[model samples]
Target: MILSLLGRLGRLWIVPVALAVWELAAREARAVYFPPPSGIALHVYELWFSGPPARLFLTDDAVAHILPSLGRLLLGWSAACLLGVVAGVALGRSARLSQYLSPLIHFARSLPPPVLLPVFLVLVGVGTPLQLAGIVFGVVWPVLINSIDGARYIDRQYLDTAQVFGLSRRERLTRVILPAAAPKIFAGLRLSVALALIMMIISELLGSTEGVGYRLLIAQSQLDILTMWAATLLLGVLGILFNAAFLAVERRVLGWHRAAL
Candidate 1:
């Protein structure tokens, strides 16, 4: 039991050790741009998380900015994934459709989504719609390509077996194709989460008010170095949490797949 506990603690020791090193280096350097993690943490707390206990200690700014940003991120990623999966599945199942559309997909994906921010702005105007479109455009390609690949490369044996069983089209898809393609689909989804966060920030960078990205832009404009670093730290932590959550879900959903392998 002690050994197991030690093993768990051992894995996490590097985090504290790294922070200690950073703290010492930043103190020694006395750089305005590079504040210690402790200070950054406190600053972020004071800025966003210092509300009444009833509200889970989240300040107004936290509610105003963080929530909207999170909402946008979730909505955008979800929309993109849903669209990608549906379209990808249809295209994968249809050779002619894929043949006609593959070139267009590649060309559209080749154009940087950030560059098209202006186009989106012109089309959709500013605010949530614009941000959502940007994120969808940027992150959808991975999911689409992976979904298509997953659907296209499914084993013939599985299809034959399904046909023998007389499974309906929906049943074949839900039971066979999706299960087989889940790993690739999940890979794309995981990658898109990171891209979603990036695009979330990028979308907010050039546009209107509110969001974590806007906070960063504000800090930079005001030369609030500490706030900037704190915001950065918060973003890093959020990224870690997002990735961790995705991994947990993937492990749970694909546990059988892993065991089979």
Candidate 2:
């Protein structure tokens, strides 16, 4: 029991240790660019959470930046999830279709999303639509590919058993295929979520008037390194929180799979 506790505490020690090293280095160097983590934390709090908790801890400026970015992120990510799952399942179940579509899929996925920013700007103009389009295009591929692989490789016995049990097509899909492929699907989802955040920032950085990304860009332009660092930190925290929340959901949904394994 003591050893287990020690191991858990030891794992958490790295964070504080790293922060101590960073603070020492930043103070010693007296570099304007490398603000200490403590200063960044304060900047983040002042910029975003200076308001009362009753008001959601967001000032108007924070709201303007955060909500729009989150909106784009959520819309794009949700669309990708829905489309990827549907398309992946369809292609996975049909080997012939997968073969026929392979080349097109490869071509589409190979196009780096950032490189298409100019085209999207022209196609959709500089607005939420452009940002959203870029995000969907970039983030969908991982989930789609993983879903395809997962569904394609489902054990033959499972499918055969579903058939033997006289399950309907929908029943077989929900009861057998989705559950079997869920682990991989969730894995892809995690990747897609991260990609969604990246694309969101890139899209905002290239164009548009609002969002955390835009704020980050403006801070950099103004040489407010602390604010830039704060935004970067905020982004990192958002990613961590998103992943952790998704993991909790995944554990709940796939509890049976864990038992089976």
Please count the clashing residue pairs in each candidate, in the order shown. 0, 0
Backbone clash pairs in model 1 (N, Cα, C under 3 Å; residues 3+ apart or in different chains), count: 0
Clashing pairs in 2: none
The numbered model that scores best in TM-score is: 1
Candidate 1 residues 98-197, lDDT tens each?
A: 9999999999878877888899889988788988999999999999988999889988999999999999999999999999989889988998999999
Each model's C-alpha lDDT?
Answer: 0.91, 0.92
RMSD versus native structure for model 2: 1.8
Best candidate (score: lDDT): 2
Model 1: lDDT equals 0.91
Model 2 TM: 0.93
Worst-scoring 10-residue span by lDDT in model 2? 52-61
TM-score of each: 0.96, 0.93
Residue-level lDDT tens digits of model 2 in 40-63: 999898989898788898987789
Q: What is the lDDT of residue 110 in candidate 1?
A: 81
